[model samples]
Target: MVNLDSSIAFLIYITAVSSAAAGVTEACKSVIPFLATDYEARNDCWEDHNHAARLNHYKRFFNLLISVVAAGVIFGVMGLDPALILTGAEKVYVEDSWEVGTWLWGIVAVFGSPFFASLLKIVEGFKQSVNNNLPPNRPRQKVTGPRE
Candidate 1:
């Protein structure tokens, strides 16, 4: 069975990492105008009759690249193995080793961040709806720990 506390902590950590990556990407774009892909830039591109399609393609690629690099750096500095974190596996090997999985985890974190945020919101809404719909006279159920 999944450990509820650890699972929750993991979710929060990943969400924070994703948010940090996004923040870094935005900061980079602000400092480096070449990375900016805002709506205004798109409109400007169209007005100037530039290759908007190529611009869009490069914009997406750079965004993904920046986020992945940010996430990878965060994970690397923390000395956390993305694969083990995702799988809940105990670390049994050398801690200092850097592998390809670390980079892959960066990709996963970038894409999964939004998904995880939406899931948390959905779960929260569901819980609120269930609580609101319960009979007033009925006592709310208290959750202590995971059930056997």
Candidate 2:
């Protein structure tokens, strides 16, 4: 019989690795310049806009991953069987329970949530940096006055 806690722990471990990978990928992507060839230092909304869009894209993905992993942790700690997750009127029990990896996985789950949250904060900070480095937008302002 498979142990519910162990299974959930394994799932949490998997989620942690995946989340970490996604975070690193996002960090790398954030470093690439949108205007690689531009030397004139012109202020273009398109470039800033594109960078913002990409940052937002990774942000959403990372947030979703964290949410899923957090859900896995919740289920695991509650002692709910993964097998019972699908069936409405079914229950599963385990006797032998847990192998060598279960404790390690549980430990990862306990730490992974905060780690992922910190990663999310780093990404947000990178996004803010991009925003700050972007040139300010200046357009023509309307003027109304009586003829002298």
> Which digits, one per residue and each the tens of the lDDT, describe model 2 over residues 23-55?
544554466443222233235678876776676
Question: Model 1, poorest ten-residue lDDT window?
Answer: 1-10
lDDT, candidates in the order shown: 0.71, 0.48
As a whole number from 0 to 100, the lDDT of residue 129 in candidate 1 is 65
lDDT (Cα, 0-100) at 141 in candidate 2: 91
**Model 1: how large is the Cα RMSD against the reference?**
9.8
TM-scores, all models, native as reference: 0.66, 0.31
lDDT of 1 by residue, 1-148 (tens): 2343345446666788888999999999999787885433435556544566667678878988999999878876777764455456576233673566667767888999989787766655555666689643556897898889
Report the alpha-carbon TM-score of model 2 versus the true structure.
0.31
